[model samples]
Target: MTALPHHLDADIWLLHMFSSQAAREGGVIRRKVRDVDRIVGRDAFVTEMRRRGYRVYENAGQFVIFCNREAVRRVV
Candidate 1:
């Protein structure tokens, strides 16, 4: 059997990413939707974000993840 790609493992990648100072400080993170899909899958990404009480927004094939649980409001 062939080995799976490293990115296919979401837990490890998520741990690494979230362990960063920026993430720890609840800074915004931007990632490509295709990258997330390829790494952790779109559903898994969304589920993980929700589980962590974070917010996610999608636009133009990109995903903007808010690392904090604060309420988000849109301003016109």
Candidate 2:
């Protein structure tokens, strides 16, 4: 696959890592949105995930993202 833009690397990587982990363990991926904003704006990061078929939510101070419906259902 083609590489993501430099500014989006960290955000995408974190999303991938959490999604992978969640897919395996049926858990939600909770991340600090501010951290993502440092590399790519929080809105952009969230938009990217949404575009990729992931669900994104802001709870407390973090972004909760999940790839699989089962994972999301389990977490919720």
Candidate 3:
């Protein structure tokens, strides 16, 4: 029912976020699910992350993105 504040496209915002210093250094990035869905639909967000070879996990209405493409293993 309301318009978003920023005019940037979903893809552009994603690219910019991924290109941030923290991401470039392979740091983890967290984003709110509602905001991402508002700016970039859930499908688009997941697709883009997959396209960029990033690993994402959702918990508590937030998404945790692993910036690196390194292999992930479960050690438990």
TM-score per model over all chains: 0.81, 0.55, 0.80
Question: How do the residues 1-76 of candidate 3 rate in per-residue lDDT, one tens digit apiece?
Answer: 7765565678678878888988999988999999799899999988888888999988999998989898767689
Error of 2 at 70 (Å): 6.4
Worst 10 residues of 2 by lDDT: 67-76
Instruction: Please rank every candidate by TM-score, starting with the best.
Output: 1, 3, 2
Clashes of 1: 0
The Cα local distance difference test for each model comes to 0.84, 0.67, 0.86
**Between prediction 2 and prediction 3, which has the larger lDDT?**
3
- Backbone clash count, each prediction separately: 0, 0, 0
Q: Rate residue 42 of model 2 by lDDT.
A: 72
**After superposition, candidate 2 runs with Cα above 4 Å error:** 1-12, 15-20, 23-27, 69-76
Error of 1 at 56 (Å): 0.2
Supply the TM-score for candidate 2.
Answer: 0.55
* Candidate 3, superposed: residue stretches over 4 Å from native: 74-76
